[model samples]
Target: MKRFLSQKINSIILGILVMISATLFLTTNGDATIFHVAKTGKDSNSGSEISPFQTIKRGIKDLTAGDTLLVHAGTYAEHFFSWETSIPNGKSWEKPITIAAHPGDSVQITPGGGKAFFWITDPQAKYLVIDGFIIDGQNQAYHGFKFQSGPTHIRVQNTEIKNTKYSAILVSIPPDYNGPSPNTYHEFINLHVHHNGSSIKDHGFYIQSSHNLVENGIFHHNMGNGGKFFQASLSGVANYNIARNNVFHNNSQSGKWSCGLILSSGEGNMGYNNIAYGNYAGLCILHRVTNARLFNNISYENENYGIYVGIASTENSYVENNTVYKNGVYGIFIGDDAKNTKITNNISYLNGNNSSDKNIGLQKQTGTIISHNLTSDPLFQNAQEKDFRLKEKSPAIDKGEAINLISKDFSNTPRPQGASYDIGAFEDIPQIDNIPPGIPQRLRLIN
Candidate 1:
């Protein structure tokens, strides 16, 4: 019968090549797995690497999706340390679920009275990855990392949140979350949030959740109440979030209503190359903010407005090329419920306290749009060691106007280098004539 039907079609192609070689040997040796944790180990030991595990809640109960617990050197006072129920969701973002801090080893967690010293409500805690670590909330934790019921791709890096008694990172979204805005894509890198809050509504990084991302952080001092009102060291309320290259300083303490970076009730929020100083308002597009976008930031010496577009209904905002200086008052303060705002190519100088204030204060010029701005002296190459760059005969270089999503400045360089933009957050380097043309003028013998 045709040789038994060609040996039954070669035994069904050898059983489909042995089921594709056992699924490529279980996708290359069954992927990840690296738990450990040691305070001289022993929670019934098994988390290998010399049978480690003493508690990070038993190495997070033997993590599931592509695991990795690490955690090695010292102090893990573990007061509330989280994760009692639902905690296992990392089948994506390249198999997340990290929890690091073993590389250079200096762990330290000290939770103590714990209202939070790392407390994630675990609504299935998405692709988690809390790297490094030194979360000390000795002030009796009121929060030093607290993400409520809506975790999304969380990723806290390099960590170093301190003293907490209020906020040192609290990505909210569960005060009965009414559906929609489930704490999206979180990510805070290079953190070093210091001293942490006390009152005045405390905060050191209190994102109310949205497409979050706070980069290169270094929020300082963190304490308030003595200032008796508002507070912040980086606070975004929600909506397309993004704060870049951060470095707010000497937060609250007593600088009054405080703020060293704040974007409220959001709507396309975005602050760039941030660098506020001695806070009390060094960048804030408050209240019902809309279309907010403060670019190339560098608010200086604050103790008052160095950028503060008022409350309630803030609209169509877009303060560009920022570089407000020596603030103590208006260096940019557009209150009266801001409308179509657009203070362009900024470089407001020597703000308030004298010389008749106002470096740019408009309580409501209807549909505001102050163009080409530059209240002189943008020559800073060293404003007494603060070095605000730009000093090659700086009239703020090309006097900026260009704004195609700000190609890059604030140290990342690459913005019009010449012929165009260069008003604030630094983009100066295009002046290289090097004087050698005179040698060619008399060399006519070559013809």
Candidate 2:
């Protein structure tokens, strides 16, 4: 029969050339470069500059995609490096590279006595960029800035993450058998995730897959979950994310549905103009969170409830100029089964001082839209010295009612005089004062 069909096509071309040489040696061993470590320093030929490469996984195993590894700024105690299984202590990247540090100097990747600084297993290998560093996870496994399988252009800026037991920037997901695209650009600008450990299930900044962006960061005293606003892991499902104008104060001692943000899982996330105060609950917009939008934020001295649009969400969104104060509960707590929600011009007050949670600022359990607010007392000169800036005949000034929050340029004065459009998250600086005219201005001399 034609010589047995030409030997069956030459045995299918030798099994496709042995599966293309085992996929090119597993993609070149998934990448490798070794300046070799063990406290490198023996006429180290780690490529110039005095035997460099003292671990950073030997310059991230010789990077690749637009490589740029240039970490030089002190503290490098890797006692005996050997990272190859593509960095997998917690998770992420393990691929794309551009790790920097040296502009204004500040690099410290300590873990000599229990290492695991750049632990990542390729969190979706995107365009990486870890800037001015500082990663000290001496405490081990807490998922400090990790990523499991999709590192798409992730950029951690002005880095400053400590301890690490669960949340100091632990991005999730990228391994459901891969299948994603659409311009992934995970970004965290100006980071400074604090002391670490919030313990009710730690987290100071935990993101889920989706074109992400966490802006102007600063999350202090994280006790347990200060910023967990998505659900792309443990089953994956989060969308176009963005948590802007960040600054969630003393992230209250973590746990028990802790807050300062724990949007708790998936659904087109978006928490704008953030500025949550002494947390106990400054936002817990729970599971299946909806169109998520907690406008011009400024949640106050929380002891509980300054916003908690809970489960079974839909059309979910409690909008408008926000500024919920001294909350003990009820500064807007619509979770009796959140539905059709969308409360506007919000302005909760001194909140119900834990009468087991009261003061009832606007607790609607169904379809919402509480208009033009000024729920009283918006006075403040120092909400713990971080200043929420407001206090000139404050009725939250002009009883603000405009609904397009997210305008802040103070100190640079790009556009002051909020037309008294003052609401929350500061914007009441119409207190202008510039006296130096006792004798100036051509010596008007009024003493």
Q: Worst lDDT window (10 residues) for model 2?
A: 19-28
**Tens digits of lDDT, candidate 2, 324-439:** 77676677777556666666555676677634235343343677655666566567665444354567777776555554444552222322355645555445656557876575
**TM-score between model 1 and native:** 0.34
Model 2 RMSD, rounded to 1 decimal: 21.2
Error of 2 at 173 (Å): 2.9
Q: Per-residue lDDT tens digits of candidate 1, residues 95-173?
A: 7777777776778887766566567766665788877778888888787777876667778877778888888787766
lDDT of each: 0.74, 0.59
Candidate 2 local lDDT, residue 69: 54
Worst 10 residues of 1 by lDDT: 225-234
| TM agreement with the true structure for every prediction | 0.34, 0.34
